[model samples]
Target: ERPNNSRFSSCSVGNISAVLDAVRDGRKRDCLKEDAGAFCGNKIVEVGEECDCG
Candidate 1:
């Protein structure tokens, strides 16, 4: 089970696909610049990402 503070609280046994679809939609709306992919591991939360602990 997920903790109350989890960002994926909407996830459940039968509705996981819906949750993934929502996430994909959100990502589409929040699309980042082409260069954003190269900075994913720099340990910084950039425009298109929620967190980067690397």
Candidate 2:
């Protein structure tokens, strides 16, 4: 059950590969932590990516 004042929801990934594999297969998650391999997002950006409209 969810409380009326609650402002968020949650879920779980049955398998680690579920999330990783989805990202590899071109699916984007709600959020991603910044790292050296990726500066802005999990998706690798190419030329002109800076001007992308979200």
TM-score of 1: 0.28
Best by lDDT: 1
Candidate 1 deviant stretches above 4 angstroms: 1-38
Task: List model 1 lDDT by residue over 1-54, tens digit each.
Answer: 436635544446447775567678784444334663546677779887898877
Span of ten consecutive residues with least summed lDDT in model 1: 27-36
lDDT of 2 at 1: 39
Q: What is every candidate's alpha-carbon RMSD to the true fold?
A: 9.1, 11.0
Q: State the weakest 10-residue window (summed lDDT) of model 2.
A: 5-14
| Over 4 Å off, model 2 | 1-14, 29-31, 35-54
- Per-residue error at 12 for model 1, in Å? 46
Give candidate 2's total backbone clashes.
0
Residues 1-54 of candidate 2 have per-residue lDDT tens digits of 337545433444345557778877878665456653434453556564764322
